[model samples]
Target: MRVVMFGYQTWGHRTLQALLDSEHDVVLVVTHPRSEHAYEKIWSDSVADLATEHGIPVLIRNRPDDDELLQHLKDADPDIIVANNWRTWIPPHIFNLPRHGTLNIHDSLLPKYAGFSPLIWALINNEPEVGVTAHLMDDELDAGDIVLQQAIPVSPTDTATDLFHRTVDLITPVTTGALALIAAGHTQFTRQDRTQATFFHKRSAEDIRINWDWPAHDLERLIRAQSHPYPAAYTFHKGNRLEILAATVSQNRYGGTPGRIFYRENDGIVIVTGHDARTGNNHGLALTRVRTHTGQELPATEYFTTMGGYLTRRP
Candidate 1:
């Protein structure tokens, strides 16, 4: 089958590589230009570079709405289009262009986590598993009919970075398998249950700010979700940003206001957590490691020499 791929970053890079290695011919490639956005900078293997190296026609577009790009797609005349991490909404005219239509590779199970930063959101929400889905594109964003879906169990100690690696490795096999099925004229794809669907926004600095009102267990998961290279989950202490690098739920319950620097537990500092913390029945959040705004990383034990202050959401 002749193919056109719309992809960006490492996800797109891997998808393109899969197409290049498959029995299909990747005739044209469309990808987004380099971005300075925080999340876009990570997992960024260049899709454009790989296409050029292989001598495939490449087009760079922030979106696929322009006439020149439309004309180019018509000229390439591909049997199908494969997209991964494309970063923008692809229109019907283009997605519906090919005979078999466009196949999108998303990094999470469909009907849930349908939007950006899916792995991070899933981990923070304590989902038991995480994986990729290959679906046929429709008018709605990521609301397509499922072609192939695969998942992996999310470990208790897994971080967003860990899940990224695990799920990414599945893209190749999923992409190839879906294409082979389509090439063989398989049309009985699964329809997504919109009632069970969820969508999330892209992560920003504001999203990582720690809210002590949350239970310690949830806070701990948030810390892991925003693991290294994706910015740390943070709070304010003494008018400075304190990024929590490692944390756990305390074994004992504590009393007083949420975010209070209460007592030392094991090898970490225990911060009172949960909106109902004043009841003294809620578990506290134990900060094992932290980073100061100045970039100095330290054990929470060394950093909070004397307790009894508050970790605020704002300075």
Candidate 2:
């Protein structure tokens, strides 16, 4: 099938690579405009570069509502459109251009995490399983009919980056299979249950802030969810922001104040969380890896050496 691809970020890059490896002919590629000034540029390959290498046209538009985009779609005349992690909402006119219509590959199981940062949100919420869904695109965001889906296990130690990689690996095969089935008219899509749909907002800096009042297990999940590629969970310490990269639920059951930096331990610095006020569980989470403001990530042990004198329990 003649396919037009739309995507950005690492997940998008993976989808583009998978399509290139498959039998489908990608007619055009659309991606967000590259930002040179962002502190951490997430997009790895220039979709334009991949398109040019394959002799496919490329469109770089920040917003899908632009009139030029509509004209570009009209010119390419694709048989099918595949969108992966596309940041912008595709206008209805463009979605209806292709004969087979547009398909979206979202990183989460739809009718659940339907909006931005599904993987991150799932981890933050302590979901044991995360999956990907390839669905027919509609005017609403991720509110479309499902064609294919595959679930992946989320380990207690899995970070957002880890979950993302696992999800991409699982989805590649599902996506390829779904596309072939759709092109061959062997598949029937089903509309999603709108009542079960839930949307999540983009993760902001504030979202990454560590709230010690939360349960130790919940705090641990939050730490793992935001670890590595997604900005680590952070908290203010000694008037400086500290990003916590790795943590473990402590076996100790001392009923200490939440956010209290306890004495340094063998593995790293131990921190206490609020006694689950509801359940009365006293065990708290511990930080194993961390970074001080404007500093590179360091083992919690190494970081505590220089700053340990200033560390005090959070009030």
Best by lDDT, which number? 1
TM-score winner among the candidates? 1
Give the local distance difference test score of model 1: 0.96
Enumerate clash totals for all models, in the order shown.
Answer: 0, 0
Write out the backbone clash pairs for model 1. none
Instruction: List candidate 2 stretches off by more than 4 Å.
Output: 36-40, 263-266, 275-280, 294-297, 301-315
Per-prediction TM-score: 0.99, 0.89
What local distance difference test score does each model get? 0.96, 0.79
Error of 2 at 292 (Å): 1.6
**Candidates' RMSD to native:** 0.6, 3.0
